[model samples]
Target chain A: MIKVNQLKKSFNDLEVLKDINFEVKRGEVLSIIGPSGSGKSTLLRCLNFLETPNAGTITIDGLTVDVENVKKQDIQQLRKKSAMVFQNYNLFKNKTALQNVTELLIVTKKMPKAEAEKIGMEYLAQVGLADKANKYPVTLSGGQQQRVSIARALALNPSVILFDEPTSSLDPELVSEVLQVIKQISTKDTTMIIVTHEMDFAREVSDNVIFMADGYIVEEGHPSQLFGNPQQARTKSFIQQLNEKH
Target chain B: MNFDIGYMFSLIPEIMEYIPITLFMAILAMILTIIIGLLLTFMRSSKLKVLNYIATVYISFFRAIPMLVQLFLIYYGLPQLFPVFTKMDAVTAAVIGFGFKQAAFASEIFRAAFLSVDKGQMEACLAGGMTKVQAYQRVIIPQAFRNALPATGNTFISLIKETSLAFTLGVVELFAEAKMQASNTLRFFEAYLAVALVYWAIVVIYSFLQSKLERLLEKPYRT
Candidate 1:
């Protein structure tokens, strides 16, 4: 579980996250949807202590993380519990998909290469890329690369995953396959905070949705109620525009 | 002028003999240069202001002085400057001179390559529980090495040509051998051409290897 209270972040004088508060229950899927620079990615990064929060506390697995209060070593411990899947996949181009997945197991976990590889194969199998595990990122399609990234994260077996625009980089025809993988993930009990533009997918897979704009969480609710009947005028207006375009 | 086929054929066996010496110096110079370049590149990229400044001074100092002068300073000036190194042979001194100078140039190439490796990849590797060194070794270095390869290979080829100047140190390397042969034979044109032919052969071989290496590195990504 993760708890954030009055989290404030700024880049120089420009405030990016202002007095934000949210709590994610264990095994729940929370989707953060917003326009560009709404601080969704920043919030995800902060959860993992990748971004240093300036004026707030984040309790992840009951350990408080902040730039000032947390010890240097504890921040690294927190990062291990939370994995991230980037929109661009971020697979090391030089490494085989399997190496990308097994790197942590061998290096951090100190598992033997053969043992780490067994686990790696299992994760790659989970992502349906087991047969392609020996190939490099450059050899993979966008969807396959993202799956390899997913397998990489699953090998970590973290408490939660933060997906930042996972399918935003994919072709329209390829988006469904990725969403299907995520949709399958949502069926199981795993915590996820997905930053996305796919409202329908959010409605289908998310336990809760928080709509953000101008660095503020304007609305938050179950997807059924939020998408069916948006409470805020801005939320309604934004959905209407998206609906009109579709 | 007319091509002297018989004379050229006669010189072939002698020219072939110096090829290995040329290659040995070039390869040795490159290996030493790459190691030195790697050290300097790491220092330049270090966050500590003093270390970075020291690296800057090193690069500028060596880069500003002509390489030939540096070679002379090493081969000639060192024994005068430091009495103990007087025991050191000319070959070692010249190798040190050429390697260090080439390192100063190649270090910049390495720096660019290291910088170009994705910052995200670095963070990701660290997050995956790799220490900074492990992250660099496993994730960052391989990627950076790839980016640095073409430049490094080019440097090696150029270094082979540059070893011609090692004749200054009295090492009896290829160019020195060529000079001795020319002066003794009284055929500067023919002898020098043979040396040029030897250098050309080396450059051709290196260029071929570079392209092959480029292809091999490109293999995994090739569709």
Candidate 2:
């Protein structure tokens, strides 16, 4: 489980996340759907300390840290507790797909090479990329790279997995393959916070859903309740716009 | 001055004796250059004000001063400033001078290469639980080294030619040996011409090697 309180982040004069707070229970799937510039990605990044919060506190799996007064050890613990799947896939360009997953296990977790390779192969197989394990990120398609990234995140077995617009950067034809991987992952008992624009996918997969706009959570409820019978005018209008576009 | 083809051909054996000396200085200088250059690069990129300032000043000072003057300073000025340096041989002084000067230039190439890597790579590495050092070692630096290969190769080739300046430090490398051969035989044309030819031939061979190295390093990154 994760608990974030009084989280606020600003880039100089422009405030992105304004005193936001949220939580997800163990094995829960929380999908955050919002328009662009809603601070969804920024909020996700702040959770892992990738983008340091100006003021906040985050607790994950019994470990807590005051963001303003954080030490090096706190950041390391936070990073170890969480794994991120980037929108860009961000696979190590020089490393093959197998190495991408095995690297973290071997280097950070201190797992033996043989054990890491075994788990790495298992995760690669899960993502349906076992055949392309030897190919570098440059040679892999965007979808394949994203799946490899997912395998890498899964290999770490972190307390939470953060997906930041995993399908947003892919071509339309490629988006389904990545979304299918996420769909497959959703069936497992994994805690995930996905920042996505796919309204239908968010409704189909997420147990809980939150609508955000202008750095504020406008509404939160069961996806069926929120998507089927939304309360806030903004949430309804935002969903309407997405529906019209689709 | 008439070209002395026969005499130049005759001097080949004598000049060949000094090839190792030239290569030793160049190879040593290049090794020093890479180490010092990477250190300076890290310093220049660091967030600390004093460290960044020191690296900036060092790069400017070494780059602004001529290579010949730098050689003279390390060889002549060091001994004057500190008596301990007087015992340091000409070869050591030349290698040190060339190393520092080439490091200044090589650091820029490395810095640019480091800058060219995608910012997301580091983020992904850290999110995967790697410490800063691990991320750099496993992700960032390897990619940066690949990007830096061609430029670093150029730096090595120039370093080899720059060893010719060791003649001024009383180190009898290829150029110094040719100078003595010229003075002794008074066939300055043949001796200097042969030296130029040797340098050119070495450069041509190195260029071939450089291309091969570039291709090898480029393999993984190319789609």
Candidate 3:
């Protein structure tokens, strides 16, 4: 389980995440949908200490981090519990696909090379890219690269996976393939917090959804309750706007 | 006033004898420069204000002064301040001098290369449970090396040519040998021309090898 209490973050004088509060049960998929500048990405980053929170506490599984005074060990512990999939598919450009998946396993986890390769190959096959294991990221398409990144994240088997708009950077035609992979993983008991603009995908896969605006969680509930009948005026209008666009 | 093409051609083999010395100085100096340059890059990136300040001043001081002046200070003047420097050989003095001066330029090349790597790469490493130091070792430095290759090649080629300056310090390198031959035969034109051709040939060969290396390293990133 993950719980956040009164989390706040700011860049210089501008507040990006203000008094945010939420929680996710183990094995639940929660999707955060918001407009640009709504701090959805910043909120996700703060969970991993990529962007340190100004105040509040983040409790992941049994470890609770006081964001105001986190130590090096706390940040490392927080990262160990979660893996992030970036929108741009940030694979190590110097390594082949299989090496990208196995790098952390070998370097940080101290797993033997042969064991790491075996696990990496299994995850690569899971993402349907086993044949492309020896290929570098540049040699693959954006969709294929994103799949490799997904495989890399899955190999870690973190308590939770954070997707920061994983399909935002891909082409329109390529977006569906990546989404299909995510949907496939959603069927498993993996806990995932996805911050995305793909409203349809979020509605389909998320167990719970949070609608945020201007650095605040405007509303939250089950996907049907939140999407079908948003209680807050802001949530209603945000959903309306997205509905019109698609 | 007469130019003898055959004599200039014949001077090549004799002048070639000193090629090893010139190469030795250049190769050693380049190694030192890269080491010092990497250290400076780390210092500049370090959070301590004092380290950053020292790195800035060091880079500025080396870059602002002429290499010839720096060479003379190391060869002639350093022994006055530290008696141990008196034991340093002419080749050692020349290599150390060149290394310090060229590192200022090489550090900038390394800095630019590190910056060229996408910010996402580091974040990915961190998010994957690697520490900052491990991130640099496994991902950041390797990519930065590829980016630094072409510029480093240029620095090395220039370093080879700059080894000619070591002649002033009584180091009998290729250019110094040519100078001796010129003074002996009183045929300054042929002797100097022979050395110049040799230098040009070395640069051409190194440039070819550099391009080949660039292509080989670029394989992973090739689209």
Find the candidate with the highest DockQ and give its number: 2
The Cα error of candidate 2 at residue B205, in Å, is: 3.3
- DockQ order of candidates, best first? 2, 3, 1
- Give each model's whole-structure lDDT: 0.83, 0.92, 0.95
Top-lDDT structure, candidate number: 3
Model 3 over residues A1-246: C-alpha lDDT tens digits?
Answer: 999999999999999998899999998999999889999999999999888889999999899999878999989988999999999999999999999999999987899999999999999999999999999999999999999999999999999999999999999999999999999999999999999999999999999999999999999999999999999999999999988987
Candidate 3's error at A121, in angstroms?
A: 2.0
> What count of clashes does model 2 give?
0
> Model 1 residue A7 lDDT?
88
Task: For all candidates, state DockQ relative to the true structure.
Answer: 0.51, 0.82, 0.81
> Which has the better TM-score: candidate 1, or candidate 2?
2
Which one wins on TM-score?
2
TM-score of 3: 0.95
Q: Candidate 2 residues B1-223, lDDT tens each?
A: 5888999988877787888999899999999999999999999888998999999999999999999999998889988989999999999999999999999999999999999999999999888778889999988998898899888888888988999998887888899999999999899999998888888878898889888977887878778
Instruction: Residues A182-232, candidate 1: write the lDDT tens digits.
Output: 888878888899999998999999999999987789999999888889999
Distance from true location, Cα of A228 in model 2, Å = 1.7
lDDT of 2 by residue, A13-119 (tens): 99999878888999889999888999999999999999999998999988989998999888999999999999999999889999999999999999999999999
Which stretches of model 1 miss by more than 4 angstroms?
A: A229-237, B1-24, B49-54
Task: List, residue by residue over B71-95, the lDDT tens digit for candidate 1.
Answer: 8888788889899888988767767
Query: Measured with DockQ on alpha carbons, how good is candidate 2?
Result: 0.82
lDDT over C-alpha atoms for residue B207 of model 3: 92
